[model samples]
Target: MELNNEVIINNLVKRFDEIVAVNEVSLEVPAGSIFGLLGPNGAGKSTTLRLLCTLLRPDSGTASVAGHDILEEPVNVRECTGVLPEEGSHTLYPSLTSYENLEYFAKLYDVPEEEAKKRIEDLLKFMDLWERRNDPAGELSTGNRQRLALCRALLHNPSVLLLDEPTSSLDPIAAKRVRELILKLAKQYGQTFFINSHNLAEVQRLCDYIAIIDEGKILLSGRTDELRRRLQSKQVFKLRVADNIETAKSIAEGLDFIFDVSIESDSLMLTILDPVSNNSVLIRKLLNANIAIIELAEEEMTLEDLYLQVIKEEEQ
Candidate 1:
């Protein structure tokens, strides 16, 4: 499949005092795709978004948003992108009603009055905040404020949306609704979403591409599924025998490439290195001892596992 590029970062760098907040980071976000940046706190995920949004001037290198250069054409870049910064809800004018808040941003973005009215009403109704549109932003609940901020972000209908923890502080239902909105907007309008989030499940569900960042460096980046498969350096598997489970376990434990072998009655849960090459050897050895292998399958790795494994390997 062909992929068109939306946001391009080239050796981007950012420093704060003695610390390098973003270090020579480079990644391409495909146009009209939901791209996620995953990392622990203080891991440069948010900083990367800030740099792309032109909120922070990079020490070196540059990025382009919707084809506008971050350094040379920041205004153009911002014009083509909408940003829901961290603490996004708090950025709204507390005294203003939700409708007024979006209206103010619409005027700032030069959105036509008629179009902004329709956009604001559509967003508020879709987010189930239509009834609360008249309520003061500060008087609304945190979740309501979050919904309002998202509406404001979308009021201009920019091509690229940069979100920092998009669903933070939302109830479960509210979070789900927000996820639905993101998916709909990305697929329906071809809006490219660049998100920094600690929510692994949300990322797994929403993002077609994801990058793992740690301490200002990208540990991995690719199509979400492809990235996980590439990072499957080692895999955990389960082995079972129709009979002679003990003998099978004994022989399996003696193999150097196999690890974390544990026996529970008829099943053996183990970690294997290079299962493609080593599983045949394992089966051969077990069968030589007259062990009947019933089942041998690898465990599926979850996003949480992928993140923790990458972070742990980085420490090593």
Candidate 2:
């Protein structure tokens, strides 16, 4: 693999008896970029992550992480990557204090005593867990525990992080904090992050690149903005008119730039090719026909909409 590529999967496949958990999957994640793997429940997301992490070998095909082949150099792959599995707290010790838990893992990762202490202290403070550093991890709230697990993953300062639902257990406020931390780390340390999430909004907000998978097959993959643009061909505008709603709808439908028009009571919803330039023409036509415009606003395309559209397209 090239140095610029942090992860590369070539026709990777994994199976259990008759069930193919992952099939002919291939992808590339650039170094220092945040990439998200999005899919529905039981879509082989976790299985794919396991293959990349070297915890489960692929039945066919190959993959590499941080320039180390997962099959041939599992040890090097492990050394260069940190993983926070879906059940993140499974790696934590219930009997150990939050600080002690991190300390122990730092030692296991071969971090020097003094350096580990400094990193742990900084991480705890950053995650707002310093106040409860001495409390047993089991006593911490689910959100706090998740935060602790994240801190542990970063304790070694590995180059690549494989995170499965990193913010699943976090409250809105804590989840926002985690997102900020991930961005900061990625920018400052040039760390590459491979995230698996069912939260479409979260992935849209944090990931520069995204891949949508279903039934062990990739349906869509590209830069987040590019994918959104590719799926959105026309701009939708919602207009509330005071009078002559039928006239307004007719005017919109008659325009060359407007492709479709729908009427809902006193409102007119228009599908136009270019809202910036075509909206004025629509309003002028409405006014010429004695229609009173009350409100006009463009409906924004959301990640949820894009996700569903792609899935629906694939099904059809």
Candidate 3:
């Protein structure tokens, strides 16, 4: 699908003192999709986010958010986007109730009182915070507080959402709810979401597009499905046989297409560079050897696996 490319970043760079926070990073975020900025800590994700939100200036390169240049038209870009900063604690007023917090941010954003009130209530309900609307922000659970923070972020209904670790502090159930809500909002309202997360499973399940960064540069970026396809190029498979587990594994190790072989419980795992064309021949060879075939399956690679691969490749 051809996306509108709500976010276009080209050769972006940011430096602090002698430290380069973001370096020559570039990617396009499609409109109306959940895009994940994923990496380990200190991988430049947050710094890139800061630049995009206009909280920090890039030393070089260019970025535009929602059709507005981040550097040249910061105010317009800010007006077009809502940011749920990493410091969610600082974003919420501890002494104020959830409703009051939203009211305050709404007013700050110049949302009219009548519209703000209705929207606040709608957001509270949408985030499942209605019952706790009157509760003080300081006293709400981490999850509730996070929900309140999100409500404040949406108060102005900006075209894009820049969320940094939206579910960092929530319990699994709460995190799941937040994930579901993110998907719902992205679909129902056609809003573009840029999420910075260290949660691999969350990113894998939620984001349609992803960018993996390390040090100060982008290691890889593309559609999630495409990335997975790239991983399939390094596919591996495990086969089980009743006898000669060791001998069968030796045979697999000798095959031209096989990279390595290891023994598992009642099975032999073959690490192959290509499985699509080699698997059938390997299985047939084992069957002809009178080895009782019990199980045969491809090893599925997780997002964590792919992430490790990206980081390792970048390191080398």
TM-score of 2: 0.84
Better of 1 and 2 by TM-score: 2
Best-to-worst TM-score order: 3, 2, 1
Q: State each model's C-alpha RMSD to the native.
A: 4.6, 3.3, 3.1
Off by over 4 Å in 2: 1-3, 235-272, 287-294, 298-304, 311-316
How well is each residue in 213-247 modelled by candidate 2, as lDDT tens digits?
77788878989899767655566778998877777
How does each model score on lDDT?
0.87, 0.87, 0.87
Whose TM-score is higher: candidate 1's or candidate 3's?
3
What TM-scores do the predictions have?
Answer: 0.80, 0.84, 0.85
* Candidate 1, 152-174: lDDT as tens digits: 88888889999999886788888
Candidate 3 stretches greater than 4 Å from native: 1-3, 87-90, 236-245, 262-269, 274-304, 307-316
Model 1: how far residue 114 lies from native, Å: 1.8
